[model samples]
Target: MSHAPTGARRREIWLLVATFLVAVAGLIYELIAATLSSYLLGDSVRQFSLVIGVFLSAMGVGAYLSRFVGEALRGFIWAQILLGILGGFLAPVVFYAYAWTGAVELPLFGLLIAVGILSGMEIPLIARVLKEIGAPEFRFENVLSVDYVGALAASVAFPLLIVPQLGLMSASLVFGALNLAVAGLSLWLFRSDATRSQWGVWALALLLTGAGLVQSERLVTVAEAALYEDDIILSETTPYQQITVTRFRDRVRLFLDHSIQFDSFDEYRYHEMLVHPAMSHASRRADVLILGGGDGMAAREVLRWADVAQVTLVDLDPRVTGLFQSHDDLAALNDNALRDPRVRVLNQDAWQFVEHANTQFDVVIVDLPDPKNLALSKLYSRAFYSLLMERLSPRGVMVTQAGSPFYARQAFWSVVQTVAAARNPVQVGAGPWTLPYHTYVPSFGDWGFVMAAPFAPKTGDLAVPPGLQYLTPAIWQQSHVFGADTGPIEADVNRLQSHALVGYYLDGWAKWFE
Candidate 1:
């Protein structure tokens, strides 16, 4: 029943389409800024909150400034062009800023404000253009609805498709090109409204974005090399995190989201100290459970024991396990432990796996990262420890890698106290006796671990494992002694409700690093 659209009607439809495209582009830029800041800097909560706050406030500034524009069509086109250029190169710019200057706060926030202001001007100018074309009175409402829908589309696509498929740097460039394309389409639709100079500017911006897209990989490599001292032999942006491996001569290092996990030169000290203590303490070592050791280093130490029949390793990221399992150099580092017949690797969330687990282990080793954020904080909570205790055999022993005893004193003791506080309802009495210990590794100074069990773990006359790079009988006994400065302080029990551990960990590390 619908008739062919008139010239004015067609112009209004095109303006609405431009409105949708602009909305999508704007939201994508905001997400990219927030995500990139979080990756470069730790404490994701703080980075995301500040970036969103600054961007939104600047958007308000842009909306207020839009009232001064006399020519709606020209203003909208200019905003689109500027936003495309700024947002297109945002990731690389921020990355280089962090690499070269060793700080990113100034440039990151400056570009965020500029892009927000331009995005804020877009919808208002589009509405004005729709009115100028003699569209319906309800056209403003239609513009708002379309804008909202486009925003939803962007939010869903960002994590599911954009980040995983194209990555942050390439995604930004792609969305930027889409923004410029919208401007070009508007110019062609209303050819009389745009000048020859406007077309020329648009063409130049498009060319620049295309060139950046073609060289995105090289740009990432150069920026990453500047950040690290060693040569970056492997780098991949997985769905979960950025996994980078660097090598200097014979020494190799693994970094997850810019945080150094381990340095090959001194990694033996960390791994031997982590695995052997609990393995020797456990009454039975036949069935061992490791929560987070995807690199296979922990499994290598576990396999050192002759009595251990099966070692079950559960890690969240498949890319990490696959790398250790397949890569020649990485696999050799773990002695190909992950490919052994006795070891079973399951890629699943540690908390979820323990909650659903029905098997009881003779020894449980939790090798998770520090609880700097809410997601990681829960893994160290009293609730998680309680679930883990239920999975431990009566004579079983459990040990977790606490933070640095010297730098994060309270955080280290918090894990020790939290483990002592966990009460397994099925087990009798009020004790999950804890043993706190620390050893000095040159790569990471004064690292700590906490061992807990239904009964007191045997700390004396331990059977030390042979062929160990570190952790001798004398060093193992000495690790239990803490100096005055590194000794425990009063720390609140870490629970899910308050997440006290995250606050303690962040505040402790911030004092030293910031």
Candidate 2:
């Protein structure tokens, strides 16, 4: 039979628990900083790398500074309190900095480094305190093991529970509260070690973070409102992305991860141009597949053809498709296309869907976003297009929305080159003729598209249906013409192995935006 632990052993156990909690909180702050930066700044790879580098280096700095500490208990408690306040408020501060100033590098990285330093000092101070308290079996390895376990828990929970449930802003505050609670636990465990002033500071920090937690929704709204020009009517933090809808006067706009998807006023121009080109060129519009366009705008145009028998739209995000399908206002924008009897919506990744699809499509329309990251870059790759070629019928045609020809010249041409490079799996040595075109849309300037087929698509006799706001026969012919400056440049074919399109896209846009 085992007896209860002695008071001395109990104190050591509690201190080790405190070390574990500190590790959890510290890593939570690091992930929050990295995710928040990625959402605001774009280029997730660069943002995460930079944040991790700075945070780990700052941790080293904090460890080096721990050697000069006089009172281990007081120093540990102070670090917890300070870390709680800073890490808890990190998201809101960074959000506001980006929203108001149109810049975020300084405050985001500054807070990241500060939080890292405090987190770094935690384990060393805990070990020192255990030694001071005369822990019977105060092995440094035990404390380090607990700390590592805590870090693992935090890493797993952050993406699965914290981010999906609490979101970045609320997660920050919730973790901040947890840190203060840990500090309070330490004070209670050793009442004589902490002064009245330390307790007072901890109480104040708790109050601030608690209030922030309660009002985190309002805080997010206010911060997000400052980022856009119009009043936001709907906002949702989906597990996949931040979905926001804003309205000004009669114009409604959609934004995914702070990037404008479409402005209702001129969306017809984009949607019409995106959908009608391939639809008009295809010999049989009986079966169609749309890779993106979760808003159902592309489906709206496809339904214009009475010859279209079935339309299958595969999008990655259900929130986007569901909103466009159910929301009264958003549904009307798509003319209830997603709800039409002939349309089938499958919320699945386009790449995976194409690879496994057994049925062939008469017209394949790729209305996906630009190749901003590696995930998106694959959709524009030669391998992806090759897979798509297998899904295209013998006389079928496919069209993809390339990025802006004026701004991202190489990225635009890369799509064309990639599509042209795709070999038809069904017909060996068959020509996958490609046509590159561009048209002006007010919302997205100089937008481009590339259409490919096993045979040379007859553009001269396009059976363009009536009622199009843009893309008339004359306009369609004009879109094929590019100015000397906007003309295609030599570009590497985008492949899954290299993901060259993402680099070209990021580099091209950065020059204009930065």
Q: Estimate each model's TM-score.
A: 0.95, 0.95
> Any idea what lDDT model 1 has?
0.90
Q: Report the C-alpha lDDT of model 1 over 1-514, residue by residue, as the tens digit.
A: 8799988888888888888888899999999998888787766777889898999899899988898899999999989888889989888899899999878888888899999999988988888888888897745788999999999999998878888888888888998899899888888888898998889999999999999999999988999999999999998777778899999999999998888889999999999989999998999999999999899999999999999999999999999999999998999999999999999999999999999999999999999878877788899999999988999998899999998989899999999999999985446668598899999998889999999888876656777568998788899889999999899899999999998998889888888988
Model 2 lowest lDDT segment of ten: 456-465
- Per-candidate clashes come to 0, 0
Off by over 4 Å in 1: 1-5, 426-429
Angstrom error of the Cα, residue 115, model 2: value is 1.2
Point out where model 2 deviates above 4 Å. Answer: 1-5, 426-431
Candidate 1 pairs with clashing backbones? none
Candidate 2 displacement at residue 340 in angstroms: 1.9
What is the alpha-carbon RMSD of candidate 2 to the true structure? Answer: 1.9
TM-score of 2: 0.95
Given candidate 1, what's the lDDT at residue 477?
87
Tens-digit lDDT string for candidate 2 (1-514): 7899987788888998898898999999999998888888877777889999999999999998888889989899999899889999999999999999977899899999999999989889999999998998679999999999999999999887888788889999998998899889889988887899999999999999989988999999899889989999988777677889999998999999899899999999988888888988888999999999999999999999999999999999898999999999899999999999999999999998999999999999998877888778889999999988899998999999999989999989988889989988755776488899999998889999999988876656566788887778888889899998779899999998898898889888988998
